[model samples]
Target: MTGSTVGGQLAEELQEIRERSGLSLAALASRTPYSKSSWERYLNGKKPVPRQAVDALCALTGTSAGRLLALWELADAEWSGRARPVSAPKEPQVPDRPAPSPAPPTAAARAGVRWWTVAAAVAGVTAACLAVLAFVGGSPDEQARTATEPPVRNHGCRADTCEGKSAVAMGCGAAGMITTLATHTASDGRRLELRHAKLCHAVWVRATGLMPGDRVELSLPAGRTQSVTAEGSLDAGRYLATPMASGDSRTSTRICLDVPDRHPECFTG
Candidate 1:
């Protein structure tokens, strides 16, 4: 098989498998955690598919990995000087790449080495890691609740500070949730939070503290913008006057994408 032929065949097979599974390009992208554009490039034969990517595609399509590996071998042989028959001497070990490291606990590692000590250490580390992960990773649904709950405020809400105004304020509380990143930091020290509902139409926002003349603008992914005026060094925070529509809300923001039919947390502007 020629290089071009192999590339074309691999792409075609992948696309065929995806279609057979009744998945659209975007759906496949969602399942794979890769971008839609990335999927398009791989399926178009415009780039060499990574081995892991191939394995993932095969698994997702319910195809056998062994057959795909065989195809890869054929492609490798064609690229080399040899144009051997598809069933010719198998060169699983491509000469260009270095050999992969052998699995641990092989004869080499076991030779004249104490295994019990290493095993004990490994067990201890594994246990510790699991404990830490358990403490850190909370259930997503629970987290959504904790974040949406109103933030605790010790003061009141009023529009004037220059007039020496001081009182407690009341407003809805919200929390932001992002599916793409494990943790997200607001660049401008601000975030939007919304009540978690089956169908949340809009988010409310308020700047907690603003100087007499402090002004901030809200930006979201896809060039959405809103202007907010801070009232007299807001002691509690300002609440969003209206709901912000979904879509590209910020021109310069690239942190998140609005997945269709999914509830989105108010991302930082």
Candidate 2:
């Protein structure tokens, strides 16, 4: 198999594990040495993920790394120019999945290492993403629940003092602080959350994920509002926040989004 093929398989396994854990990519990165950007690339198959990174994810979620290790070994071999012909442990059981590329000419090179390792983990690792109704697939029917963030640390600023300052930097909206007062998602899939730190008497807008042209805003009772626009690719897939505001955002304040090609949408908790 080609490196890209193996990398893609590994990526899928990682993404599934991530989703099941109910932790956002940001959370995964925060708990591990890897940066959010690194997780983005690793999960998206844009770069070669380190073998040890899997260990870190397993550590955070309390999952055994055995199965993921199998996929990684296959990916590592391809990246290192060592390709094998055998299907990933029982991959033959599901002849229905489409492959990314054709296999190599022969399966002769170091067969022992790949087979032994693959057999140990392949039994249950890939079946969720690739078999029959239950053999190699997962339940996709359940609606995806919003991933909650941890509480924001004490920002030590409230009301007037927090106005016009980054809620995250001030340690307010960056963390869940409290559970989301309200949440909204644009038709195009950009997400928004109203986060509050009651002790600080502050509330802010946290757009969990944004695109190039997305805009985020939070408003207070007296026509006060703060907004920021998404900039470049670096900003893409990143969390963006608005300055802090006061009052019961659950009812009084309005949170809105201006996304490309869609009508502006607003929500209040």
Judged by lDDT, which candidate is best? 2
Candidate 1 residues lying further than 4 Å off, grouped into runs, are: 1-4, 76-269
What is the C-alpha RMSD, rounded to one decimal, of candidate 1? 22.0
Assess candidate 1 and give its TM-score to the true structure: 0.28
Window of ten residues with lowest summed lDDT in model 1? 162-171
lDDT of each: 0.43, 0.66
True-structure lDDT of candidate 1: 0.43
Residue 31 alpha-carbon offset, candidate 2, angstroms: 26
Question: Each candidate: how many clashes?
Answer: 22, 6
Candidate 2: the clashing residue pairs are 127-136, 131-136, 151-177, 152-177, 250-269, 251-269
